[model samples]
Target: MSSSTPADAGSKPAGPLSGILVVSIDQAVAGPLCAMRLADAGARVIKIEAEDGDRARDYDKAMGSTSAAFGWLNRGKESVVLNLKDPGDLALVKAMLARADVFVQNLAPGASDRLGLGAAQLTKEFPRLVVVDIMGYGRETSYASKRAYDMLVQSESGICAVTGTPEVPSKVGISIADIGTGTNAYAAVLEALFERERTGRGQALEVAMFDCMAEWMSLPLLHFDYMGVETARFGLSHASVYPYRPYHCADGDIVVSIQSTAEWVRFCTTVLRSPEFAKDPRFIDNWARVQNRDALDEAIHAVFTPHSCAEMIERLEAGQIAWARVSTLHDLSVHPALRRIPVEMPGGEMAEMPRPAGRIVASGAKVPPLGADTARIRAEFAGAAPAAAKQA
Candidate 1:
């Protein structure tokens, strides 16, 4: 709501969060992606980095100039370098936040306190500032001091237990715990902004990767608690859902799901051409089918394994069964649902990145070069009061 460069005033920001100024002190996935979502929705995000910049910038250098992760997360942000330990540099950031509607940070626990940028302190000092803290674990717990990474959170939250085959536990391939925490932070910021509009005040919010992942594991937790049913880790198969996994084809596998008895009936009678299998006592209902999945799958393999991909797909279409072909990265590169836009690399060359999820369609400007806007920003705010009216 402050006029200190939420976006350049003449031309407008595109989405609901337009003109929302965000000052982010962050590095790595959870923190950067949280701010990235805000930037995607038209917030003017100032990404503060150390003198070396975000380490992710050099993470394999796969995006022609910058790391693909850095290119994706830091797009459309104004990069500014600062050392919070230095009084002058710290003052500069304070001025930036003075004008910012939101402040996000993912410093190791207690690091914010060491820098005097703690959420409790910031929100108290500037009541209209929405402060979001991303952590590995809840601050109130003993694990608060423990270092957290995506894999660690996944393991701790029991996600690893349910993710892979029970004999060999494995973490998710993607940084899901980090993404979950980041998305939660993003949603929390929106909720806080809505409340700020009503109350004319802002609040501090926290989302830990561990806590967020635990919440995501709630259904399995409930099952484990009430029925003592620890989920089995069947590759590509849901622990509870029957016939909701890949069936062997000649070349590979085609995933299928049957959520209802009628769908199961269709799958058995139409797809497998075995009408009696649907009425078999051992595979009558979802639970029974789940219990007898190994036998049913063996029978299914006999029917499906002989078919080519084309024949399997044709049968699937005719059967009206819900199914999908697993797409590799090659397939995904040109998929119909994938949307991408050109982003200017550190150099003038352009690289494409995926658009933001959901319907808030926007293509942001070039990702800023490391500290590219630093001198201009410093010159503007040099003699500024703590209130940040210098920008105005």
Candidate 2:
């Protein structure tokens, strides 16, 4: 990887996000994740950052001094650090926006509006541009003005309420709130793009982190609404489904989900070595297993006790049952499906990071280096020269 070439170096061919120009002013996860998805699909995304750059750029240099978050989400895009407060810088960004097909931003509440870069303003100026506004909360909610972080939204959305051990609630370790909002925003932008193709006009999208995660919490809310009781944190167990959780094996833990009665019959016959057990009155069906939960759990434990994790996996495979290994973070780093790419940094350092999971068949696709296209962009946008970079 060289400074003038692939910032995060990879040999993969161009992807589907190719050709489309996406201009984004973003910090942290949500907006970046969305843009990254577009980039993965072969979009020519330009990430316009503050002069200091996205805070995520410095969020822990885990991958040999390169921020893991940045290395992950920022690949396949050009990074242009500009001070939006400066008139020249603002003009430069607006110039880019004027030619952009999609504009995304995740600034503080009312921040874009105050700067006259709100969706309304942008839509008026660029009627064909799809403007996506990513916020932490719904624009008119009670917590609209309140600050929201990833974990905070997860907690407020009742995800924490139903996660972790019963004694204490815990937020999901990952940024579920931010990621979910970004995913929804991406889908909305795609839908808006499709609509624009027919109407020849763009649409404004408002995606809130709290709302996205809250929508995921709907099932638990519905349970409480109809049953007058909230779902409890049972750790690895399904809140409403019995025998659908991890069980102890001799050397390690294995998770198994017997979702259907037919599969449960196979499990009893092959894994449990007790075909008649499936016909027992106490464990005849899903509801019976739930009603005789204690007995059912004990029976499952007995069947699983003598086997090791690998042995249990084999049994589950033989029985054609769905199973999982309780893997650790360390284990995932070397997971067979993991893909890594090298990114060129300022100090002549190259950092290898995971590639975004958007595999498309194309050629000559790559991530641009920081300011690599600055002079060309200036010349092209200032109307002093022809486009210095290839269009699409």
Candidate 3:
């Protein structure tokens, strides 16, 4: 393992994405995330925005003024506010696309085509330009034009159906749908780029949040299809295991899972101090224990009531039982393995944000301010830019 920290490591002379130039007509999470990942790996990203800017800028009041999401994902890119409806700005965007290795967009449904930026148009004009489109739903579907948000997509894709307690299905607290789409788009774009090198032709990539969420919901979807029954939510409890849920240890609750019969036997003997309980016919196997869950829970609760959380954890650890504290969001921030990067915002203030995981990089650069490079880009590409292509 390389002992070099990404923070202390100097910029590499050769980056994995060094020669790439990406143009993005994007706003919000999915598009920004894709562009940011490219930029982080040393691609020169031009984030084309509407005059009003990405709505994510005003998402929250935390961190003084800048939204945390924007700060996290918009770094290391040149932002340019453009009016796509205006011929001049549209022409400028096309000029960038002419020279770009990649062009990505997540505009409102049909808006990209209206502005002549859809995959069909770009693929025709720039044969070798990788075009990636991010949408709420796939274009082939009837509901393609509906306004789609992360929470709505999660609900629509049936992710909420299997998550949370049985009484109330809840959307994931984070923007999981958007992130999923972004991640899928990123991987798809990389794959297309690789294939492009071989074929000498770039391909178009499309990813929708609904489609991504549906793919993620496959496990539950398959289970329901096979069994012809919906899985009931157990509120953090295992559906087929007893004494495999959170239990109060004197004051606070701790989660533990006793999966195998041998682990259950050890828990009964070492933790519960009732070795005979393991051999009780009613609680012998997982199925039987699950059937008698009420009684099993009561027995385990009684054993836990007398012990402190630390004592219970120590005993559980010694018994080789899997256990963990019910961690809150705050606990996640201070987790032992958590990595943070200091973000320097436009206002010259720095804040530590969680670093992106699984990012392979050989170079680094800072983000440009909104429209910081608009003049330079316009001047550089003005003469070479094709006239505004008529919309179909």
lDDT of 2 by residue, 1-392 (tens): 00122234345345444446788988889999898788777677778876567888788867544576776676667777677788877777777766678899999998889887888888877777789999988887788887788998898888999999989999888889988899999999999988887987887899999889878988889878997867888888887766788888899888889889889999999888899988999988886786687788898898888888888888889999999887788988888877766665543466656665555323333434456656655655564221112111
Which model is ahead, 1 or 3, in terms of lDDT?
Answer: 1
lDDT of 1: 0.85
Give candidate 2 regions above 4 Å deviation. 1-17, 339-355, 358-372, 383-392
Task: Give the alpha carbon lDDT tens digit for every residue of 1-392 in model 1.
Answer: 87656323334356677779899988889999999888878788888899999988998778777888788777778888888899999988888777789999998889998898998888877888999999999999989999998999999999999998858999999899988999999999999999999998889998899989999999889999999998878878988998898888899889988999989888888889999999999899999989999998899999999998778778778888889888999999999988887777786668877776685445436777889888877876676675524323
Per-residue lDDT of model 3, residues 1-392, tens digit only: 00111221244333477668788988889999998887777667788877667888778746555677787788877777788889988878877777787888898899888877889988988888889989999899998999898999999998787778989888887999999899888888888878977987887888999999999887768868997656667778876567789998897998989889899999998988899999999899997997798899899899898889998998998899999887889999889978777666655567777778876433234444667667766676676635224211
All candidates: CA RMSD (Å): 2.2, 4.8, 5.1
CA-lDDT, candidates in order: 0.85, 0.77, 0.79
Candidate 1 Cα errors over 4 Å, as ranges: 6-13, 387-392
lDDT winner:
1
Model 1 clashing residue pairs (backbone): none
Q: Residue 158, candidate 1: how far off, in angstroms?
A: 1.2
After superposing candidate 3, which stretches have Cα over 4 Å from the reference?
1-14, 238-244, 258-269, 273-292, 360-367, 385-392
Give the range where candidate 2 is weakest over 10 consecutive residues by summed lDDT.
Answer: 383-392
